[model samples]
Target chain A: MTPACVIDRAKLRVNAERLKTLCSQRGIQLRPHVKTLKSVQAAQLYAPPGSAITVSTLAEARYFAAAGYRDILYAVGVTPNKLPAINNLLGAGVALTVIVDSEAGAEHLIAFAQQFSSPLRVAIEIDVDDHRAGIRAQDPELIAVARKIDLQPGLQFYGVMAHAGASYGCFDISSRSAMAVQEARQTAEAARLLGEQGIPCELVSVGSTPTALVDIERPGITELRAGVYATFDCVMAGLGVCNYNDIAMSVLTSVIGHQVDKGWVLIDAGWMALSRDQGTGSHALDCGYGLVCDAKGRLLEGWYVAQTNQEHGIIAHRDGISPPSELFKYGTTLRILPVHACATGAQFEQYHVTDDNDCVSTVWPRVNGW
Target chain B: MTPACVIDRAKLRVNAERLKTLCSQRGIQLRPHVKTLKSVQAAQLYAPPGSAITVSTLAEARYFAAAGYRDILYAVGVTPNKLPAINNLLGAGVALTVIVDSEAGAEHLIAFAQQFSSPLRVAIEIDVDDHRAGIRAQDPELIAVARKIDLQPGLQFYGVMAHAGASYGCFDISSRSAMAVQEARQTAEAARLLGEQGIPCELVSVGSTPTALVDIERPGITELRAGVYATFDCVMAGLGVCNYNDIAMSVLTSVIGHQVDKGWVLIDAGWMALSRDQGTGSHALDCGYGLVCDAKGRLLEGWYVAQTNQEHGIIAHRDGISPPSELFKYGTTLRILPVHACATGAQFEQYHVTDDNDCVSTVWPRVNGW
Candidate 1:
């Protein structure tokens, strides 16, 4: 395969170990979100011994459950239609926990859970920084929703979880650290409030890659849930969350043609292969599509994918330093450091994994779509 | 399933019929590109009996070929490594025609073909308006490359093809029509020049969704190729190429949570489900990620997806027409019309195809990745 998702196993191992060490030292359980990997092999490596894992889709939950993952967290807000699938997983002895931020969502799930003999575990989603989903941490509904879970039949209020998605917006270390503190504090405060209301909120979870890696303080937080740290990318590098050398995933591509006069070299890795994610666009240094590198994963000086179509990527120089035609001749193999590893990795069906010396070690299949 | 790719079969059939009628009236062969649909079911409905269909990836060629499609055109510029896959299809009695624009590309294919018994068919890609790939129509290499293909052993010059990609930049019909004219004239001119050099050029193809739909005049074109028209999108609607009512594909999602103060309804269809393709960003009527619609596919006036995360989409009123909280309460099902059909379609593994009556008749699987 010319244009394929390539994973560096060595770098991935390093990242996984780094996260494990950080979480272990912080006295918090590391529930690596499987949404970023979606690979059974990767999940097993990231969360070995069947530790609690997080997922963004029901498909991922089923896949991970089938692969011997016992403790699973469906990180997204649970809707009514997905209850059957969740029930099936829970019935199959999988400890599947769902999150919701509204009374209607909890009531809907509660009504569906009534038919099941086993109680369905639930978590209250709290808003940390207004990034996306969840009820405001200080909102009175936070207690009301938890009470609904407690009062409902065949439902168990597990704890509270909050994803500080706004941490991604912070490119500076201090800002990201501050967002982490706020995430932990807000989620912990919500749990504390629920506890004061006679609701036993046992598990308090808060995470995002930036916060999970940068923050050393965790007051009441029990578990840290983060994804995309195992396979870092240009966005994380721009955020100063990880070194560029720590990026394990890249798009392996080959040059097809070029416009010599315009100093444009066309490659097979387009948006369909790389994904149309400009996550680093808001950063001080915006990688057009991604940073370009040689086949050995060495940076090609200042080369980058300037533009992309459905099936073609135009690689150009950032500093107008167009190299000789010999450097980018047709059929030359190249590697692209993706802006967002999660987005780019989702574009492929499998990853062509390589070892430290760039030797093909294995090909892992990726489960995509819900 | 929430956050699922849904196809309006009635509108899809209408769009297919419209294209077939237009091509039939113009005396040109309709080679609908399968890059958009990537579904064998949709391909049969669009180009039944495999009448020279176009593909952006070798994966699509193999998929369609397995489903009895013989006349397949690998439209993107071919690289050396992909020749094996192309040759595999050709060896299986599939007439897999590839496009090439550079001398190196042609030579590489010629060398690869020498290892095989059968000659490889190729089309010389001519640059229509410097949109992306291809040699300029008037460039001296146009004839030189044609003669090289003629002189090279194990290589057959099929004809010339040009994709007026720049036609997408035209938001008006007149400019798009003019681009179509130039596309046809330039590609036809390249074919004529090849003929003058004792090289026989049979096929002269020129197309783009905007150009194919807007251009009725093609003096030297033998076939028209287009992809996105069969599943129109918000970008097409913004370009005045098709009405919003004609779009056949959407993301079926449900309101999970909300930010009442900001008037934002959080949905499950994020960029992961509906791709991060902001193609309509440059258009006059730019939809943030996609246009909001009801479950029945009726347009929600002035509503759009404001932002997206991995698995979360924030739906808000584009014109600040915040309706009552009851209208977008949690668990309410809604649909999102994508900005680019091809980009969004690539996100799903299958499409939940429904008819005009909102009845899900069948589930069509899509061939993703290369």
Candidate 2:
């Protein structure tokens, strides 16, 4: 069927190995974020059973935990309401570490842990670049939050972690490398501050796809965590972190109709198949919704999905050239390289894993929703 | 748990009845498009079993058909690859009607139907506005496409249908009413053209949420179809098609953390919970991702989701005012009215149907994938 999520197994392995080699050379533990693919089968290739993994939702925590992943990190800032689910995961003998950036968050965790029997591992999120959530590394509040967790009988101060999400804005290698150093240094600084307070920080984690790929010395960081690296997207390609050929995931769509005069080719894949994350929209060469490709995953120059309705995608040439009749024949299947792999991958329940010959080798089911 | 899709059953019924009354007064059949909620249980309120309904995918067709919905319309342009699935649905005794906007599409359906024992009903999509996929109503190609289907022994020329998608661009009642008339008139013209060729037109369908709501005469239009009207969203509110209070769908999220210096209050609902559809970005009031509301669904004056990561949303006041500590206490659950109900609803596998008192009454599972 058309409008299906396709994963090139060969490219996926190459992408996964690239990150693994980078982390191995840097002498840092790689905690692959399973949030991108959210598939147990996909993780089998990179993050095998028992490998430390990062997840964005408790559902993923429970899923990966059930799949024998003992060490799991719930990367998102924890809320009081999700404590019950976390408690259940811990009760199941999973070493699930949760992150908090505020004293208020620590207070909630402390309160929830009062009723919990086992000690909950808590990590303080350090803000290296003021990118989304997290407390500033230099903020005295970082030590205060760590102390709050250490003081609680049912809580264990795990460490400090930071994500240089701003590195995504960096187009060149030098800037991204600098951001990577800043990410590692500040997160390590937070851990050092906690260490000075007699709270032994076991882990210091920092990463972003661009930052993690940079060959830079990260002195204090013990672990590197990054999602979307395993399935490089148009965003990563636009940022120069990876080439477009490295992108493993794409939406396979069939050309249904076209507006010949307007030079628009309509496909079945809309935001429903290809997500509305126009991550490369700010780049000099914006891949509208996604970059268009041939059925065999070869890019069609200048053609991108310009607009999308719920179930219809409009493919337009960047130069306003009409779609060639031979190339875009009715019912001809085409592939679309996603702007953000995580967002596009989340839109489907399963991925049709294709081998080197572009034949469906297997189907990988994804764990979606919280 | 927070970051869940919540639907107000009371408001949903009210919105459904409003359209039902309008269609009844105009003496037209109301074929509600189930693409918004995609839940059979949700459709039970607006469109019960035996009612004519429209679906975006074959999966939805099979889902609703399994739930006893016999009269289904696969509204998107039919492709050759989907013929097998459509055949299966027909084999299951579903009176499924497929649509085509081009002669190529009609040719594909005709050729695919050759291998089948039963006839396939096909509708000619008339373009009322140059918004999306459809053949122009006045174009001679429309008649040519209809004639091709009529001539095919295995295909039945169903009728003409048009969706005034550009009606969403109209922010006033008068303009929307005019678009509605144009939508109905143009679609009726296509059916009349088919009739002039000695081919009797059975159905004349036309609609869009904005156009469907207008109290106007649709002379030859036999049926009115709409999806988002059952759950008005920020886009509909921005267009003046419906009030914010009329909206039934929202994402319930808990305060996760905040960046106080930047006037950002982080919530658990990001683009993952409330989709990345910025349908109202061009409106006077741009609801970034969605408009914020109180836990009980009361619209907050100026707070809106300003930015989003995969699992984190940054809510900010429109006036750049810092988040008030009292209102945004840690773990305080809030609601977010979606920009596009259909997109937001598609994010979740099930919707939490709430009562007037804001208590969850039931859970309705949705049909998500294609």
Candidate 3:
């Protein structure tokens, strides 16, 4: 499989197991976000039987639901147009959970739900870090949104959800821990605030790959939702969240030619394969496009895919030395550990799973697009 | 369609017709590379009946073949692993052309061809403008590789192909023209050299949207392969190759939320939809990830998607002033013209084609991955 995405099954299993163990120890339910891989095989490993799964797109929710993921959470803020699809999934016996941060969004859901005979499971998103979406946890509108959902005839107020995507920017352990604690507190406080208003907020969720992997305590957080941890990447490595060996996904490419004078080794895996995600740009060490590794998943010292075109990646030495032509002969296969697993994995249609012996064992199809 | 890829069918027709007329005037065949759109509908418009098409991956070649594209060229350097797929296409009576830049690549093709009863049409990739792949036009190995293919049975030396990818970096018309001239001359010279060696070189292909659009003369170039011209992008607009109006492709997204204080209006279209290709980064004007446009394809002045997450694009004014919250309210549909047409188009599985009235006329499915 040339120019393919290779997933180290062992590393993926280890990552998933570690997360499961951590969540179990903290007595928090693990609702693994299936949006990262969007593979039923990987989803099964991360989200076992009776476990809920988080999805960013309705397409993913539909795909996973077809694959027997009953409890589906469309994590992204719900829009008016997506109501029909969410309603269809719910009609098909899927316990679909939708999120709303604004009253307008809640109103849209309420209006849409009135057309349906059954209740639509809804969650109020708390803006714990002000990263992307969600209403500020301290905002009075949070209680209003929850009350709106609770009072609605055909909408069930599930609880609250928070993702401190801001924690990804924390490069230090202490900062990540602090962000994790803050995430937990803010989300729990929102739930507490809702409970004070006579609303039964059973679920209080908050998570991010970095925060979920580091935080030692979660006082009131009942559930965690993380995705990238299952397939660690250069950004996670740069943040000291996981070692390079923990990264399961890689782009398998072949050396086509070289620019010996420019010290560039041209590989078939370009931005189209490795993805144009410069996730490690803000870190102490920027790994260009991705870290170059041999076919056997062993890292090639001092080498990186420094530049890329649509279909050509230029591998260069980090120390500014020319790579030997004989060492990187034409047609030799190489693997590239991507900068961001989610972005990189989304580029490919499927993953070529490899075993401990570095032999491709199976091919897993991935769901892409919205 | 919310957070979808929208292709302006009228603009695409204009772009395709312009390229077809230009190639006709220049006395060259226009074999538009389908790697950009990867849609049979778009290919039908670009290549038309009896016209050849170029592809970067065998998956594309197979897809086009299935869609009744008889003549196809796998433009990327062929490796041994791809032989079976090429042979499968060839066996299905598709006139597939494979490219090779190295002697090792040629030998692999030769070895693969030996197993087949019929000959494989091969093209020597010439390195014009010192771009990504292909052998240097002046290199002696160019002749050696061509001779090797010509000498081998079950392998036919088709001609030469050159892509002036470096011309993308040429921001000025004069520099672009110079690069175009050099691209045509180098590729033509390589074909001439092969012809002088008593080998018939039927084709001399030179390409890249910039070169094909700007070049005034092509002495010996027989065919031109350009893809992105069918769907102009921000990078092409920044290079002055095409106007913003000529950009047929735009990601149709809706405002999901906002950070009013930070002057950020969040859209549903993120890197997953717009792509992470920062093609305009080196230009005088970097249009962040993409240029912001209203739902009707009208440009929103001084506003662009400055930053993006997996499924969220943060739109902001180029200046520091915050956008009025009323103008970009949640659920307001917005269109984003991407930086690189190829990279952005590859992110989607289909294109929602619209007419001048901004009414979606038809949905065209796109093929992805190798």
State which candidate has the highest TM-score.
2
- lDDT per residue, candidate 1, B241-347, as tens digits? 99999999999998898877778899999999999999999989889899999888899889999899889999989777665576688888899999999999999
Q: What is the C-alpha lDDT profile of model 1 across A1-370, one tens digit per residue?
A: 7899899998999999898999888778999998887999876668764788999999988888888888989999988888887888978898888999888898888778777658888998988997788887789999998998898878889999999989888978899889999999999999888989999887899998999998478899999988999999999999999888889999999998998778899999999999999988888878988999889998887898989999999999987776568778999999999999889988998999999789888999989988
State which docking tier applies to candidate 3.
medium
Cα error of candidate 1 at position B116, Å? 2.5
TM-scores for all candidates: the values are 0.99, 0.99, 0.97
Best-fitting candidate, scored by DockQ: 2
lDDT of 3 by residue, B1-370 (tens): 4789999999999999998899888788888988899988887778875679988888888888887888888887777777887778878889888888888888888777777646789998898876677788779999899999999989989999899989988988999999999999999999888888888688899889998997488998888889999999999999999899899999998887777778888888889998998878888888989999888999988899899988889999988778876679878888999999899999999999998888999999988888
Query: Top lDDT: which candidate number?
Result: 2
How would the candidate models be sorted by lDDT, starting from the highest? 2, 1, 3
Q: Order the candidates by DockQ, highest first.
A: 2, 1, 3
lDDT of 2 at A204: 93
User: How does residue A252 of candidate 2 score in lDDT?
Assistant: 98
Q: Rate the local accuracy (lDDT) of all candidates.
A: 0.88, 0.92, 0.87
Give me the runs in candidate 1 sitting further than 4 Å from their true place. none
Model 2 local distance difference test score: 0.92
Clashes of 3: 0
Shift of residue B176 alpha carbon in model 2, Å: 0.6
Better of 1 and 3 by DockQ: 1
